[model samples]
Target: MYLLMMLSAAVVSYTATWGARYVGNRMELFSPIRSRDMHSTPVSRLGGLGIFAGFAVALLIASQSFFVKDIFRNNDAPWGILAGAAVIVAVGVADDLLDLRWWIKLIGQSAAALVVAVWGVRMTIIPFIPEPYVIDSDAVSIALTAGLIVTTMNAFNFIDGLDGLAAGVAIIGGTAFFLTAYWVHRTAILLDRSDLATLLTAVLVGACIGFLPHNWFPAKIFMGDSGAMLIGLIMASAGIVSTGQITSGLYDRANGIPTIIPILLPFAVLFLPLLDLGLAVVRRTALGRSPWSADRGHLHHKLLDIGYSHRSAVILMYLWTCVLAFGGLALAVFQWQVVMAVNLAAMTVMAGVTAWPYLRHKAPGLGPRSSAEEE
Candidate 1:
């Protein structure tokens, strides 16, 4: 049933993207080429509309499914998620067309997150503490939830510079999250505890997969802020829902590693984007610029600067994301020692790949001239 729902979303999103492309062209809603932009041509940034269409339709279908109808009947999280998605998409579309100020976009993102947090998707406990620390204050819970969603939205938005980068990363992270949630459901003592998380991740992954073809290199359309933030909002919501109601007992029985894996997995899965966000903020602030200032100093841009092709740069980041995400996920189901060993090996390989350009340049008669020499 979940598979069917995912497929339905993919089909709807794929179809909707064509429509969005048509509307964008007709309306002249193309994103302007900036100094930091890779593409010289203006591309429609309305792909987010298509993603939302697919995501919304998928959830609607899930709500009707006999296998998962209980998610709607017993919980308000799904409704909150849907409402938040709608809010972000509208804000994103506006930003894509009008180039709204950063603060304005932040306000919109916060409002969207609040809708979900208030609707019962807020975090209830800190997952890594020896004993789960229950959040007793509603205000604090809502703030934390909103902050996470906003940060995630911005992180994704930060990394959306490359064609299909955001969507591909979302698919990787979402799939890992889905698997983790499903594992939690299987081992969970309580029934349906992780169902919402599982369902959300499934649909999120499907939406990205459906949108990827059009958004790939030599892109037909861009997801713009709307699609990127939408992906972040949903991914964060899934993480929150997965851990919101979970007890320490679930972790105790699930693995030999510490119970921290449940909460830590989301951070690990999104490590690359969050890392990019952190570095960008620090780099900009040190230079007396607004953290929201745009520049070509992003990780993807650095990749290109260092001689990686557009597709290669995007794929390498995807590889890095998978290594972190799945490596962290392995701790949940596999022995800590084995997971650590595998992760270390994967990271070593990735590091070599990431530094390949420099390595080849430094090697004697190995490859073409470096990007520096070419420039």
Candidate 2:
């Protein structure tokens, strides 16, 4: 059943990418080259439509299935997520076509977040709170959920600086979310898992894979704000449904530090983007600039300045994301002894690899490879 949903989304996304190749130019939806843009040439920027098409089709179809319907009946989260996604996608499309101001974009994001909250999808429980104050007030829960959605949307938006970077991260994070959520449903009997969240995550993974062929290095089309923001909302929605709908029973099941794993897994999966977002805000504010202002000081840019080629930098980040996300999953499922042993071995290997470069001889062109050289 899950495979069917993923494949359905993949097919839709693939078709959308192909169609965009021809129609995107005609629609005047190319992302213009800017001072901070990594690409020199204008590229089709509305690729998120393909992702949305694939996801919506699979979800709408699944919502009709007898088995899925049984799991999601009367669940407003699924419908609310879709509605919020639509709002974000519209904002992204408008931004891509009209170059909307930052405040305008924020307004759109806020509206979408509020819409999801109004649909009864707010985070009612504080996942890591101590036993005494586990539950939060209605106002606090709604505000935090909405804030999380908006922050995630922007986090992903800020990291869409390199070819395949945002899409790759989305795929990795979505996979982690799916695995962790599925494990929780299968293992944690006290909790009622949202089947819709699991299904949507699977579709998100499939959409990212389907879109990557066109978005990878030397890309044909960019997902633009539409795709990035849409993915952010999807990821945030998955997290909300998975961890936020907690019951007092869940608190009873979670004992001591073990309780934190469920909360930490989502943050670990999304660590890179959130980290980048935080650093960017701090860096911008420290320089007396707007936190929303764009710059070339991202981690990717630093990697390029240090010695890595564009593709190399992207691949390195991909490896880190996989490690962090899957490592978090391992912690959720495995014992502390096993996780510690594995982490120690992995750390040793990584340390050796890092030191090897310093021990090797330097050559004239052995520094950072240029773009033309990469070609």
Candidate 3:
């Protein structure tokens, strides 16, 4: 299933690249709003439309394929997801063409989230839980989901600051989600329901794969608002869907953590984007500015400031993403011994380099104490 899905996604992504180029060269929906030493002249910014097409088709095929027909036929999840996705895409398309106000975009995102909530698909906390873990608020659930949707969409959007940056990160995250979802599907099959989680995983992988060629280093086209918005929506949707699959009607205490693993799956998968958003907010707040205020303080911006090429910054971030991804995967699978061993090894290497005496001495007064003093 993974093989077929990847193959189809590659084809779709390659084709989408061409489609994006055609639209950029011909339609003139939107052009590069910002550029910083990008390789291509007047870089294409709305390439996301092509990625969305491939993503949609790829997911539909992966889910409704002959082997998984029953899963598709049984539930309204797919259709409901599609409706919500359509809303996000439209909102993004408008933003791409015309600079929509942030508030307008927020409203659109909330409306889309409300669409899902109305499908009897709202997130409900585990009722009757003891203190600390007890979060019992329907309004809070709604707000969290809406905010999460908006934040995820913008997290992907805002991180599109360097060439191939957002696309590469999306692939990393999609791959992580795919692995975790597949794990959930396997556990689900052992329990009862056939593994639709894997099908969703396959679709996500295919979508990212298809988009990467056009979006990789020296990108000929960009996965503009269309692609980023769609990517965020599906990823958010996949997280929700997998959570439902994993925690349905099976609450054995031992299996609970493993089952609820997908809840944290999306956050870990897209941690770079999420982290970027957080840092952006903090930086802005520290400067007594609005969170939406733009600046060159992003991690990518910092990498560029430090003399790394755009591609290098993107690749370096990708490496960290993979490390966190696989490490988190190990944790999810209950391999604490392996995870701990790997964690220790990582800290050792980090200590060797980051704590190197010579480097630290060269940049005087830049040790733990300085950092602590700053804090």
Candidate 4:
């Protein structure tokens, strides 16, 4: 069933994206190149429509499965999430077409988040407390959930500056969380508890993979704000459903990492984007500019400044995201401090290797000298 849904999603996504690309210019759905933009050419901005189409189709088919049906029957979350995703995609499409104001976009995002929060998914508990502190208050839970939705949506939006950057990271992050959700579901947790997360993550992975070929370097179709924000909301929804709402079902051993994974998994999977988001906010505010002010100071931009080509910079970020995301997964699955430490060390080594070329010039004569220098 899962396999079928995945294949269906990929095919639908590819077809939809191809169609969008075909009519993008005629429809005025091409994103204009700007000084702050990475692409030199205008490209289709409705790629999010492709992604959303794939996800929606796959989800509708998957909903026929017994487990999927059971979850939907038991709660309104499944429908609510769909509704919210639709809202986001609509907002994204509008943004692509009309270039909506930042606040207007935020309002749309807030509405969607509220839909998800009040209907089914919410961070109703904080794992850090000595005893699990359930946030039973409706207002507080909804507010917190909405904040998370906005932050996550903006995080992915901020990182979508490069071809395949956002899509690749989404694939990696979604895979990691999907694995975690699957493992817990099969081994330690109940089927219903993890089904939504696992299924949603699977859909997320398929959608990204399907769209990646078109969005790769010299991108033919940009996901634009619509696709980025939609994926962000999906990721956030999976995290909330799989972990946040299942706080009481967390592993009992407080001394180990698995016990804390319910809280850490989301952060670990999305560390890079979240970091970029944080840095952007801080840097922009410090410069006395609106936090949403556009600039070329992103981590990917820095990679370009340091001589990495667009594709290389994107692949490097993919590697970093995988390391952190899988590290979190390993911590959850094995609960071994030593294993996580080793993973962290290996990630550091990878980072060093990636940076070595940039630093090679600093060590005079250490790197191959150019012919001009030899002369």
Candidate 5:
């Protein structure tokens, strides 16, 4: 059933992207090439609209399915998610077209987060404490949820520099999330628990997969801020809705995984972008610049500088995201010691590849220097 829905969303999104590209070109809505831009040719930045269409339509179809009838009949959270997605996409489209100021974009993100919070998708539990505690203050819950949503949106936007980077990461991260949520739903004893989170993640992954062809390196159209933030918002909301609603006792601990897996998993899936976002802010602020200031100092830029091709850099990042995200998921279903061993091995390989340029440079007569090395 889930597979069918995912495929449907994928097909719709793939078709919609063609239409979006055509409209964007006809209307002269190409993304402006900047000094830091990876692409030289003008490309439409309207791919987000295609993604939104796919996601929204998928949910509407799911709403009518008997299999997930309870999810729709009982929970308002899905509607909130849809509404929030629309809000962010609108903000993203405006920014794509008009180049809105950072504060203005922030405001749009907050509004979208608030919409989801109001519909009961806000964070309710504080994880990582020895004894997980429920958040009793409504204000605090809303604030935390909004902060997470906004942070993720920006984190994803920060990493959208490379073609297919954001969407590929989204597909990988969203799949891990969906698996985690599905595992929870299957294991939980509670009959009233909703699978809304699982459904959302599946649809989100499908949309990204569908859009990837158009957004790949030497792309036809960019998802821009709209698609990137929409992906972030949906990913964050799935985590909040699934993990936040469950208590620590409900987490499956038979596999020797910590109870904090529910909360930790989301952060792990998003680790790369969030890490990138954090580093960018610190780098900019220390230089007496606005944290939102654009530069060629991003991780992808560093990869290009280090002699990685555009495709290879993006794929390497995808590998990093998978290693972290699925590695985190492994803890929930496998023994911690085993998962840790596997993760260590994976990270070692990733680090080696990432540092290959420097390693080759230090070893004379290894090979001819690449263009980046010569520069």
Candidate 6:
């Protein structure tokens, strides 16, 4: 059943990738990225629907499966997640077409988060508590859950500036969840718990892979608001479901990590996007600017400024993400200290790569700068 759903998801996603172009053509909605005003030709802005469509179809199919049964059977499982997702998709589609106010989009995102929160998924961690299981059923927990959900949703949306960047990152993050779910499923004796998270993550993976070819460098279609929001909400909620809601089913010791360490798994997988958003917010607020102010100051912008071609910059970022996701997995299996040592070495190497452009700018043999260089 899982295999069938995965296959169905891939097929549906591929068809949607092709169908998106036809839909955009029929709707006569095409425009290049805003950065590329130089190109007057209109390109499709509705490519997001392709991804959304594929994801929706795959999710619907999974809903009927035994794996998805937890979500369908649980009180907050099926309806709340689905309803929240619908809100995100609808709001994003409207924003893409009509350019909705940023606050309005936030409201939609919040609505979805609330649905997931109030119904099924919420952080039960008590403030200043040590034991993992002790929780106060109070207002603080609800507030924390809402705050976390909203922040994560926006985080995913903010780092989606590059062509294939967000799609790839989201897919990678979802793949991490799928892997964790599978890993836990194998070691633990639970069947239903793995089914829901695994199926959802697999569906997300299939959808992203199907769209990646078109969304890759020199993108044929831009995912825009609809796609970004859809991906963000799912990635965020998937984390909520997988770690906060489900990991407790596993009977493992603390294993030296924090009681809430499992929650960090998704964050590690999505370190790139979340880091980009967090840094952008800090930078903007420091300059007394709204966080939403559009600027070419993202990590991608920095990569470009330092002379990495767009494709190279993107590939390097992907490699970094792999290091974070798999490296952390290694930590979970091997030792945290060893993983840290390897991570430090890899980071040093990456830093050298990043500085190569600066080194190349240095004068050769202390001679006068070339006329072209001076110019």
Cα TM-score per model: 0.95, 0.88, 0.82, 0.94, 0.95, 0.87
Ordered by lDDT, highest first, the candidates read 1, 5, 4, 2, 6, 3
User: Which residue pairs overlap in candidate 4's backbone?
Assistant: none
lDDT of each: 0.89, 0.79, 0.66, 0.83, 0.88, 0.69
Candidate 4, 82-137: lDDT as tens digits:
88999999999898888888789889999988988888588777666556577889
Candidate 1: give the clashing pairs.
Answer: none
- The stretch of ten residues in a row with the least summed lDDT in candidate 2 is 248-257
- What ranges in model 6 sit over 4 Å off? 1-3, 31-41, 66-71, 126-130, 133-135, 191-193, 245-255, 362-375
- Model 2, 1-375: lDDT tens per residue? 776778888888988877876798777667678888888888889788889888888888778765565556877777888898889889998998889988999999999888888783777656555542354577787888899889999999988888999999988878987887776665656434546567878999998888899899998888989899999888887777666535524323333345566557778878888999999999999999988888998877776665667787788778778877887777766675777688677767754553444333264654558799999
Would you give me the overall lDDT of model 1? 0.89
Clashes of each: 0, 0, 3, 0, 0, 2
- Displacement of residue 5 (Cα, Å) in model 2 is 0.9
Query: Which of candidates 5 and 6 reaches a greater lDDT?
Result: 5
TM-score of 6: 0.87
**Model 3 lDDT tens row, 1-375:** 655765676678678778778877787654555544345466666677666666667657767665555666667666666677778778877877776777887788778777765552444543322211323687876676666667787788777877677777777777776776566455543533445455555665676677777777777777777678777767776665655544353322222344445565677777878888999899899999988766777877766665566777788777767766665665666656767689678756744643344455457675447656878
| Residues 232-343, model 1: lDDT tens digits | 9998998887676557466665466555777788898889989999999999999999999898899999999888999999999999989999988888888888889999
**Model 4 alpha-carbon miss at residue 195, Å:** 1.3
Minimal lDDT window, size 10, model 6 = 31-40
Q: Report lDDT (Cα) of residue 66, candidate 6.
A: 64
Q: Write the per-residue lDDT of candidate 6 for residues 217-325, one digit (tens) a residue.
A: 6777767777777777676666665555433645253244534446667778778878888899999999999887767788878877877787888777777877777
Error of 6 at 68 (Å): 4.4
